[model samples]
Target chain A: MKKRITEPVKKPAVWIGFGVLFTLVTPWYFPAGSWSPLFWGIPYWALIIIAVSLALSIFITWVVLCQWDTGADETEDER
Target chain B: MNMELAFGGWSGILVLGLYGGLMLAVGLFAFLRHRGVRESLDEYYLGGRGLGAMVLFFTFFATQYSGNTVVGYPPTAYRLGYQYLVSVPFFIMIIMVYLFFAPRLYSLGRRFSLLTPVDWIDLRFRSKRVSVLAAILMLYGLGNYLLEQFVAIGQGVSGLTGGTIPYQVGVIFFIVIMVAYSWLGGMRSVAYTDTIQGLALLFGVFTLLIGSLIYLGGLPSAAATMAANAPQKLGAPTGTALTTWFCLLVLVGIGAAIYPHAFQRIFSARSERTLKRSFIRMAYMPFLTAGVVFMVGIIGISAFPDLTTAQSEQLVGMLANALANQNAFFYWAMVLLFGGVIAAIVSTADSVLLTFSSIISHDLYGRYVAPDASEYRKILVGKLVGVAAVVVLVLIAWYPPGTLYQIFVLKFEVLIQTAPALILGLYWRRLNTQAVFVGMLAGTILAAAFTFAGYRPLGVFSGLWGLSLNLLLCVGGSLLFGASPAQRERAEEIIAFPPSAAAARAV
Candidate 1:
């Protein structure tokens, strides 16, 4: 008989890393002058930030779908 | 203060009445269906752990967004300019924070049949002092949060009705409806009504945005106006403003994720898949909701320039009022928007009130005050006490102090103190109970002291200062006191679950 082995997912780092990159690190890389260029009324820099935020959202969906497992036939234990 | 309605008079009154009646019908339906199963705390507080993806998703939406997103966020954006773009990303950070602990916490909830966050604390630490202190902290945070909703209800009604309805009347009217529904069906009524209210708010907001663009001109025009009038508002943020933005992202992300109401929603999920699906949907909500509202606020900078801070608080209502006077279609939409604002506030209040009573019933009364009490007796006491709490909060709302932002800070400052213990305890086995207690106490005292003293060191929020100390103590005290080998083993067992389960299989 062969035994089946499953490895735990390590995608939480992707979420944390992307979250930091979009919110904290990326904003500093843009120069103050870069905000002057407008795309459809939104500043270019602001549009970039919104795009990063959208990516973060999509990343979260992927992590939740691929990474979490609730456990099997769990009986309720009284605390 | 003088009140002005967006589409005041009979239309606002009619819409409010219809919305109220619909909520009542939903509550009655839930009550009748749940009558047989209402004896247990799980059924009443957690909806028998049977919420599907849609109901769970909407309830989480309503609780997290609230009336603040509609009424309060605009003024901050008006003041901060493009800097307020931080709001959208900060909301996304909240879902990410949940990823750190929600999976393990959900599994723990199933394993121990947990009812409240305090229950998990009591189970993990096995310390009466720790549990009682945590419950008190949660109660204080929740009470303040509920108080904010009451104030928002009164403001939204008076502002939207053009003074046709007095602030006091507005507060009383919605409070009665919210408490009635929650009392009748508990979590079931709250979650179902949340779905309705959430849809109304989403529709109302998008319509308002479209109307604003069409009437006041589009974003390109608005940006042009700002460039000519207030170029600073469109420029990139640097210096202290940029630093504050970073603090907000971290603080609000962690603080909101560990909110007691939000924590309970994790347990309310029917299955691990349901919980995950709901969260996955929730991740994208910031773009639709907060992102849109942020654009509206920025557009206001061009639409109504030179307004003072106090006047800017009325940005949404003023814009709605202008649009209502444009055409019949916008007239009805503005009415719906204002009514939805009030409903959003009520929906948030009901969720907070439900979680508040659950804490009192399950953690305080059932666990400490009357250990042998039946579920019925405990729930009865919780309901009565909850009503009494509403009465006290209503009185405070009648005489609101400071601005909405100040009251907002007060709640988050206190609530975030729980994060170090709640989030860290999930992964770290050697966290000493005494360390947690000391850290919480020091954090609470420091947060309150800093806030009262009007101290903002380097423009960073007072909550972050308290959290810094809290995390320091939790980490330092645990190292100094240390857990026993047996305690470490017990923690390992509590946090572990079979990877084959639907929730852990992915992890």
Candidate 2:
């Protein structure tokens, strides 16, 4: 079987995905000083931001696991 | 953060003293196991480059989330409301930033046996001036960082012990304990204690959050308080708040990932897989640590309403005190929480001090001051200088110069300026050394001036401003005058990634 060696930095899809996730995390797109529709005490916009933050984490997990093998530790893996 | 509520002085003192003893024991244990820790720089500083996934994760944890996350961040959350929610994503952003450079850097570290971040700079540029400037910036930044930890340790100790242990005494006691253990086993000791400290901090914050929820109502009550009194806290950020939020994400994301100590940690990973695993753990930590603390702070709003900003800074202590009063179980837990706070501070200080000494031992003293010195002698010199630095910083903590305090506070702001040289050097082969040096120096000066003058153009942080100019000059200058052919070849040899299949087989 062949090794699937790659790096996150070499992947354009990873970059594009991160760019989108980072933009959503900042919560600027929401209306200013308008936080009605509070859910369990968290405002509506805040919930989206939380979900976005989680997405960033999950995206990071995917990048780390699936897209970041550089074959730098091939010997260790063999061991 | 200044908290007046003391959780029964004797328990605080007892727990802290026992905690210090346990740390000393851990150091002794590491020393016994790794007998060569003092004789070799790698064994001493990077734990033989054998840190497992868990130790590396906790050590990284200790670096980014210091005691301040517990003692300081909650107060900011209480004052600012959900706007401080940015803290969570910003920390996640740090891991995101790391994905850009860490993969290649880790490979390079393995190839070169890079001992410190400065060693990487030296290998990449081979310029004394550039490497030395980077070292001084890192040392100055780490020194300031250590000093801030010392200050926080004092405040945390005094707050926990209810003034029984004066701030001066508290600082001195922890410094002694920290220096003692660090001398015993070096990086092994720091990483081991960081595991313990990280666990304690996690337990403490979870308890605080649960206690706040049960004892002082939940976020809904806090949201109501904000809606009735200050709706802006609950509302999504806009205007200056929005800009501040964006600046925080960018500054903290890049700055923290390249913290000299944090950068050096990449060299300490046992393997690529270990490092990747540790980062995965870290990518989610902000939710557990910062997210929980933010909730505790929000709960503080309804529990103690209308506190002046000054008093709101005491939110954690006030909350801890209320919890302790409710039951015995809570009383002990709150005490442990304060102990965790102090432990977190010490863990951070230990790592900074270790990296500070490595720069002196491996980069400056070993390289320049005494070229023929043995590794043992170099290590000894680094330890003594580190101790000397601790004394100076502790004195500064005690007798803080009134107007000069801003210089000490420039730790992160100035340190962030080194990001371009450190990170860009990893990938961009044509990055000119002269451009790096000039950009770093210019950026630091601009950042210091803006920070001291309280000048933030368009609600952006001074550090981010400095970073922008730094990047501009670094990228623009490199474009105008790229590396020479020979320099290009060397950079290609160093950073061309994976080193080709044949080279790896030969190694």
Candidate 3:
């Protein structure tokens, strides 16, 4: 039986999209209230930022694992 | 927030001694094992470019995060409040920037057997002036970086010892051990020790967090305290603060991504698979390292309110002291935390020192001063000069000119100037060599000028101002004196390697 091979497509947009959403867009929306609804001891807006930052990291790991291929000419060595 | 009350007595000395002894042992072991390869720069500088996934991951981790993540970052978090949450994302942005150039650079490294970042500049442009300028820029940045680590080591040691040991003694003790190890094993010892140090840092940081939360009441209590006092810190950033946040994201992201040591790690991966796996792991590190430390900082704001700016810098020590007073277990944990912070700083300093030596030995001396010199001689020259540099840096660290934050920005501003030549040079075939040199020179001057002038134009960082000028010159100059037909064709051919080939080079 023959195996199938698929090329990994570079999806920089995935990283860029997340980068923009988290860094550019999210900062604008942080709650203006200094004392606000708290989520698990964090202010609501701060919690949201942390949550999105978490997502960004996860997304980056996924992209790194799936999107990059350094080509076939290079060979692994134990030196 | 009394730093001098953080640690004292025999326990601190015992821990510091154990950590130092362990580092020395690792260095000696690496030296004995890899002595055969000592004559060659490749073995000394890059550990023969054969690092596996775990070692590569941890070494990169230890080098990038550094002591600052533990000691310096918390204060920023305490001062800026939620505004400092930008630290977490900015680290993530570094990995993104890596995605832009590292893949190709890795492939090129294997094809040409590139040993240093400046080696890549030499390969691409084949211009002596361009390579030397980039080398000087990297060396300056590494010097500043090493100085920061030296200063941190002194502060961490003295603070942990409750001023039992003088700051000068603390700095000298670690510098001696660090330089000894680096001189012995080069990259091998550095990477091996980095694995141990990185784990120590992780364990210590998490333990500190648990101890903090357990003793100082959990996040909810801290949040309530913060809400009652220092409300501005909790409020969202507005106007200039927001702009500065964006600028930090870009400047730190690009500046850190292109660090000479970081670039060399790309060249040192055992395989493309190893490189990719390592990066995947690094992506999550911000949360575990920077993100966790940021929370620790936020907790300090409520736990010890009303600290002046200088006192705020002692947030870690203050918290550790309070925790140590609670129980035996907390005391031991705080000891480990301080020990780990010192180890982390040493690990970072060793990496920088290795890169610093390599640039002087290979790029400046071997390439220019004495091209006919043997490999062993070049290695010797690099080592001697490295020791000398450490001596000078120690003096500066002993009598630091400015605050830690100022020294921190000094390195990044100059280092980021090299980004255009390196990052754009990877893909843009027509990037003129002369243009790269001019841009780097102009950018570096403007950056230094703006910084000294204390001109941060409209709340923007001085580095960004210089970078803007640098980018303009690079793009404009490239057009003005366009690449010759031969240069264009050569660049196209060099860059046209299939991505898979680049990946497979290490397979």
Give the number of the best model, judged by lDDT.
Answer: 2
Model 1 CA deviation exceeding 4 Å by range? A1-16, A19-26, A72-79, B1-3, B400-409, B497-507
**Candidate with more favorable, higher TM-score: 1 or 2:** 2
lDDT of 3 by residue, B51-122 (tens): 999999998887788878998899999888878888988888788788878877887898789999999888
Task: Flag clash pairs in model 2.
Answer: none
RMSD of each candidate? Answer: 3.6, 1.7, 3.4
Query: Per-residue CA lDDT of candidate 1, range B1-507, in tens?
Result: 233874787788888889989999998999999894469899999999989999999999987898789777877887777888889988888888888788878877887889999999988888888889899989999999998888888877877777778889988898888888887888999999999999999998899889888877777877888788777677777777777878888888898898999999999998877888899989999888887888788878778888998899888888888899999999999899888888888898999999999999999999999989999888988888999999988877776556653544478899899888787788788998889999998998898888978998989888899999988999999999888888877776675445234245334
**DockQ versus reference, model 1:** 0.47
Q: Model 1 lDDT vs. the true structure?
A: 0.83
Number of the top-ranking candidate, with TM-score as the measure: 2
Please tell me which model should have the higher DockQ, number 2 or number 3.
2
* Cα lDDT computed for each candidate against the true fold: 0.83, 0.91, 0.83
Please give the distance, in angstroms, between residue B46's alpha carbon in candidate 2 and its true position after superposition: 0.1
Off by over 4 Å in 2: A75-79, B501-507
TM-score of each model, paired residue for residue: 0.94, 0.98, 0.93
Q: In angstroms, what RMSD does candidate 1 have relative to the true structure?
A: 3.6
Models ranked on DockQ: 2, 3, 1
